[model samples]
Target: MSYKEFLVQLSEASGVSGYEGEVSDVIKKAFKEIGHEVTSDNLGNLICFKKGKNPKGRKIMLAAHMDEVGLMVKDIDANGFIKFTTIGGVDQRTLLCQEVIVHGKEKVYGIIGVKPPHLTTPEERSKPLEIDNLLIDTGYDFEEINKLVEIGDVVTIKRQVYNLQNNHIAGKALDDRVGVAILYYSLQELNKLQHDVDVYFVATVQEEVGTRGATTSAFKIQPDIGIAIDVGFGKTPELNQFDTIEMGKGPAFTVGPNIHPGVFNHLKTTAKDHYIPYQVEVAANHSGTDAWPMQVSCSGVATGVISIPLRYMHTSVETVNLSDVEKSGKVLAHFIASLNDENMEELLCY
Candidate 1:
């Protein structure tokens, strides 16, 4: 399948924090088709370990979160309307009037309902709806709703993949879904090259809630180098030029205290030497990606980050450029291939 088609299938699948079975199934199937065996940790983190030629060589890790910001059923009212709570860092403002899929006993389709403008006071209309006031209308009565949905079932906004001009596409859950896509592309690229380091590509769970998956997985793998693939803010009129990256350029290589200087320099030089396009994103402290926890895991690890420029993050209409994803994966494969015993020692020295 094409990368975009796989990405859309991933985005449309429901996988909230602590509940990544559906997403795991899709990714595992893809990995298995490529002759890689998939394993899961106690925390639901999916791990695929590819052994390298050198047994004593350095262990490398690539991480991307699989969970996306969404909602969960908090309660079911007497009238059958579903009251829900936020999962991860959901924007309450965007939950109104959107179609949603509730993963319960069965897939339940519903729409978030809001007060009509005719009934609302002008002052109320001036403000966005709050989570407390939002209700999901499933068009099913209490008994039917209970039979299908239960409290704590996850709800994801339904968005069709809309292809835009150039290679950009719009949909929900692209924040780190694109990051997961990088793992797929990287695996394909790695198969063509000879690398000495055993690479572990992880599809982590519950990252939207916290970097829970990265923390535990890093401790388990304890790789010499960890690279987190994620999304960064894309260019928009309201955002500052210095704070956002332009779409269709390439992935962003981050530089900051949290990032290992040696790894960062290698990634930059690899991109340049190989003529792979890339942008730079500066982080003051925590990059808010899987790299955050991986850096401090198991006596501390050297961590790096690569982000695809993303528009409207954490919303249903999240946008990304497929070219950027392609470049990011290529750069990563090259960086991994460039790692050797001598350079790995130097990189870990400081």
Candidate 2:
């Protein structure tokens, strides 16, 4: 499938933290066509394994989270306004007056309700809007809304993918859904490779709340090398150069506490050897991807992170460049093909 098709399918799916069944099913179908041996962990992480040409080869794990940030219903007021709490980090300023889809009885549509400035005092208008004060309006009475909606139902922003000028794409859930697409496409390309390593393409869950899925999946796989594919911040007009990378340039290789030094160097060398365009990202502490937990799992696996630069992260209208997405996949495919027993030893040193 084309990247555009994958983006639409991934963005439209509802897979909040701990609720990844639907997304896992979609990904399993895609991998099955490529002849991968697919299975799921007890925690619902989808693991697709491909046998290598060399029998006693190193085990490599490639991880991409399947979950996205969303809200869960907390209460329903008498006027049918729904109160909610965020499942992940969400900016309250962006929640006001936006359309949302409440995954209740049958996917009810609603809008985030906010107090108009006309009704607010001058001091209140200048202060930040508290999350507790916001509610969702579904145009129903309390009794009627209660019949269709209930507490703990997932709620996601209602948005569709669209193409922008300068080769940028915008939509919701690109934070990690784009990572899933990259991993799937890379595995498809890697199926043609003659390698000496056992590869596992893992679709993890609950990364937004915490790297819960990766933690459990890595413990089960016990791979020698683990690589996490996720979205990173792209340079925008409002963001400083130190905080983000340029969009459409290429994928970013993260240098951080969570990533293994040798794995990081190998990724850079592999990208250069394959003539793939890539950038470097510096993260002094935790990388904040699945790599964080995967690194320390089961006697400490070699971990690294490859990120696709995305703009306006965690918002309904996240943006990414298609060229960067494809380049990331190529880099991963090449990296997997270049690994072997000797290189695996080198990776273990750092």
Candidate 3:
């Protein structure tokens, strides 16, 4: 399948953080299509492995979280209006006037509602409304709504995945699902290349919450090298000019303490040697991606991070360039193909 098709299937699915079953199915199906078997762990991580020429040589893992930031039903008011709590790091500003799908007994469409501005004082209009004041209007009152919806049910913004003027994709859940798409494309590309180290691809869960899924998966896999694929801040006028990466230029390769010097060097060299367009990013302390936990897994691991530049993260309209996703996967496949015992040892001795 094409990258857009793969990403759309994942982006449209209701796979909120800590509730990634739907996303799991999509990944499993894609892996099956590519002739790889997928397995899930107790905490809901989906794993796929492609052994290298020497299966026992070195092991490397690539991870991309499958969870998306969403909301959970917190309370059902007397009139059946729904009150909800933010699931991951949902911005309060984006919650108003949103179209959401309540995942209760079935998918129920609803819109976020609040006090009418005409009836409100000028002070209220001047301030951002708190989440506590937002209510979901599901067109059902009391008894009828209670039957179809309940407390604790998940809610996701209803959004349609679409393309932009320059092959850019805009939608919800692209935060890491696009990373997963990169994994899919990488595996497809690997089918054409020969490599010497075993590769493990993990679709981790709960990254939006605390990088929890990668924490456990890394501990279990204990690979010699690990790479986390995630999204970086896309350049916008609102952001500091030097802080965000340009959207269409290329994927950003992270560098700093959280990243092993060896792994970073390998990624950098691969991009340069193969002429894959890429940018450099710095993470002073922790990168806030799955790479953070993967670095400290078990007896410690050599880890690196590669990010696809994205805009409006944690909101309904996250955006990414399709070329960036394709190139990220392409560069990663080449990086993996370049691995061998001699080079790996040389990289790590630093």
For candidate 1, the lDDT comes to 0.92
Q: List all candidate RMSDs to the true structure.
A: 1.0, 1.3, 0.9
Over 101-220, each residue of candidate 3 has an lDDT whose tens digit, in order, gives 999998999999878889999999999999988999999989999999989999999999988889888999999999999999999999999999999999999999999999999998
Q: Spell out the clash pairs found in candidate 1.
A: none
The number of the candidate with the highest lDDT is: 3
List where candidate 3 sits over 4 angstroms from the true fold: none
- For model 3 the local lDDT of residue 222 reads 90
lDDT-best of 2 and 3: 3
User: How far off is residue 200 in model 2, in Å?
Assistant: 0.5
lDDT of 2 by residue, 1-350 (tens): 66557767888787878777667777888778767768998899999988776667679999999898889999998888999999988877789889998988888999997788889999998888888888999998999999999999988888889989988889888889999999878886786677788889999999999899999999999989999999889998989898898898899999988888999999999899988889999989989999999899988988999989998888989999989988999888888899888777777793
Q: Candidate 3: global Cα-lDDT?
A: 0.92
Which scores higher on lDDT, 1 or 3? 3
Model 3: how far is 274 from its true place, Å?
Answer: 1.4
Per-model TM-score, in order, reads: 0.98, 0.96, 0.98
lDDT of 1 by residue, 212-316 (tens): 999999999999999999999999999999999999998899999999999999999999999998889999899999999999997889999998999999999
Give Cα distance to truth, residue 138, candidate 2, Å: 0.5
